[model samples]
Target: MSNKVILVVLDGLNYQVARDCMGYLNGLIEQKKATLYPIQCELPSMSRPLYECILTGVPPVLSGIVNNQIVRLSNEESIFSLAKSQGKVTAAAAYHWVSELYNRAPYDAVRDRFTDDETLNIQHGRFYHWDHYPDEALFLDAESLRQQFNPDFLLIHPMNIDDAGHKHGLDSRQYRNSARAADIYLSNYISTWVDAGYQVMVTSDHGMNDDLSHGGILPEEREVPLFVIGDTFTHAETTVKQTELCGLCCQLLGLEHCKPYAPEMIAL
Candidate 1:
């Protein structure tokens, strides 16, 4: 039998900010209702490349999606494709790049903004084009999709944190506020999702730097947070890798992992 999973990518969130600002998530950790694991993201720590890395379990060097400017459908097998091929439903409420990578290439906002075609890798989608799109709206969109489609695997990605980091720098008040706001919205929905038997993973594509940018060797650009809410995890102290997320998703959904993955990430 398959299980339901929701992966929430809080784009451009740095580990320090997440550890300090996401109060509700931290509350869960304090209450032992969730587990927090700080993991280093894949290089060059850019958004688009790490997006592919997180979903496909392939590094930028191997996937060739090394930068944010590379706009093309992914050549590697991804979580969405793997789920779809196994007769499972997949969905995402994320940045348009996700649609371009999996559903269609060269995304046309008018035609590709909202997709529900069963023929596509991402069978259902609610993609946003704006970097500053409100995170609450995106979560509501994801909740709406969950209520309607009940997809086996769902990707809920919000970009406001990344947007603030870009405009205000990592240490600015705006960036921290953005993280806090996202945590508040997550507090509203996570309990219902957990009660509904959905395994949820909230993490980031990459970190942000004090220079108001990313895609470099700085620890601020590479370190991000991972929070797991499910019964499958051991809750033990173990090292986790960013690329292992794909395999972990496959494990949650009862699908075979398509690429090499680190078993200790999930420790199932």
Candidate 2:
């Protein structure tokens, strides 16, 4: 692969909230340094299902990882698997669910929390088991991984926004503050990644609702944002789907996509 990619999944960040509260990202949009695409996530709008969807380009129904409780290793070809197969390095500083989905099952907190085995789908990992794990710390962990391994594909999944949304509803101050805080944290590393030739894509798995719960069809629970950074995109108007992200990652990392995706979403 000739290019590298960094995919940031800010769990439970709503499109509208991100548009309003993420000042740093919106500023980049105004300056034409980034592009924002408001995307409606797949049905059910839950974290686990959409996480699988984003990485594998498969819908919940087809993947059989339809719910959060259906925890098992994924069977489909993910960006990590594809990159690794091509002898590219892969890493993630994400929630333990990601470790469970890609590296091992049942998440042995003792052994699976911090892994650096090349045989695993996520070759280098720093897995956190709880939602309360600080977002700033996760970013630091991600940066450490990048500096150490220079992974070809890196997945950074932070859960503070979702944790805030779950504890206090989407309408609450905590949820909004969490998004803003994440934006601030992102400001610390995005330019460095871009300078180092990483195509950065900041997005969310799903959204949250006023009742402090999700898994329904409400707009508040489905619509999320995708921020495309670096020099690979065009200004043309485009519509993107949640499942299309996996293909986009493959395209950025110079890999052949296994699933159908709109090539118009990115420019070569």
Candidate 3:
């Protein structure tokens, strides 16, 4: 297989916020290791639905993911399962649902869920959330898991920005500042993988409107940013649908996407 892949999900980041807040990302862009794609997530742009879009390359309407708590995935192919078929080791640091989708089967012992329980846990502070955990904490967890498993494919979801947007409006100073913080954290975390000869990917589940809520068709809430960075493979994508990511990830890993679900290719 190709060098390992690290997929970083900056939950609920909008394109404008990404441009203004994520200054460090330009480092990768300059290396031609990064490409910014303008994408509008599917309707009901909540975590589960939009995540399904990135993971399965399908929209919420077809994926049938209405809420974050629903554990049952649609009868569709997923990147994790595809990676397994390629015999690539996979791991994920994400919400509870991620554990549900990619539990034990092919996963090794280093594969397990983590809690943000500060003291009893390894790193997360007492302020962790039940639904989403901050990137700060997930980064620590991902590092530990990676060191142990050295997985071929790793999916990470850092979610404080989503929480900030929900508790405070997207226009609020908190949301903007949190978006910036998200950028810095991801930049630092991904660098380790790049230094270790791994490909890095950064994207978002959905966007947030001024009201701090999604699930609509507004550009602010629907548009997200996708960035891919690596030394071995560096290319640009001017426009791409959100549904195309799953197939793209599989392709990057040197594997085939599920039949009939090819990711829309961008003209280089």
Candidate 4:
């Protein structure tokens, strides 16, 4: 456990939504338990693009990821690849694209796929697409994996907030509640990792619009929230960009140095 790291992406949480609904996270920010940055995501502001951007430290235009429709990752030196090369185990519990991304990697990944009545067993804590709580299984699955595999790097992407946003739009009661629900679920996982001397980095892929839709570069859609917390985390006042996220994770996890996307934003 020399370089343990947990990266949690809350999918499509806007900065304002997180500030308003994620009370525990806010407490960390206010008390300086964590560093919070309102950072810039790429244009198009889609999950796939932002995910790739954060992983490769490359912009969407250069990485060839522009929207939800695209999934191919051209950048060879990803956080996953770097960790895997160093003999560090990596695991991810997330959306289908996660499987698509890790198809060839040695990483263990569980997708929050849509399930049927016969396939989904609530007694086993599994649910389906229409359940509105499909992501709860993700956290449970991740915990189980953590105990069994003892992975060095864990990436958890919860989808409930994204679902709620698309269905009811931002500023709706459902949207805010969904954000809170994600916060609650993430708190459990964060505590588990921190107790084991792991560093945690939480960020959003993109923000949302009035209709909770995101596909452009408007400030609301492009500004995502970032939080890095751990026992060894430095307390500093600095802003960061979405592309700089990969470097930040690498630095915190003691991995090979990846240059910051915005050199000016890094804290000395």
lDDT of 4 at 160: 81
Per-residue lDDT for 101-212 in model 4, tens only?
4342222223334211212111111212232556777788778767766767777777888778888887788888988887888777676688887788888998878866
Write down the worst ten-residue block by lDDT for model 3. 118-127
- Residue-wise C-alpha lDDT for candidate 3, range 53-150, written one tens digit per residue: 78878787887777776776345677777777667777777765554443422222233344332122112211223645556777777887778767
In candidate 1, the residue pairs with backbone N, CA or C atoms under 3 Å apart (3 or more residues apart, or in different chains) clash, namely none
Candidate models: Cα lDDT each:
0.92, 0.92, 0.70, 0.70
TM-score of each: 0.97, 0.98, 0.83, 0.84
| Model 2 spans with C-alpha error above 4 angstroms | none
Residues 209-261, candidate 2: write the lDDT tens digits: 99998998999999999999988777457899999999989888888667766
State how far residue 2 of model 4 sits from its true place (Å).
5.3
Q: Where does model 1 exceed 4 Å of error?
A: 262-268
Candidate 2: residue pairs that collide: none
Off by over 4 Å in 3: 30-33, 104-132, 232-234, 259-268
- Note each model's CA RMSD in angstroms: 1.3, 1.1, 5.8, 6.0
lDDT of 1 by residue, 2-35 (tens): 2889999999999999999999999999998898
Q: Report the lDDT of model 4 for residue 22.
A: 93
Model 2: weakest 10-residue lDDT segment is: 257-266
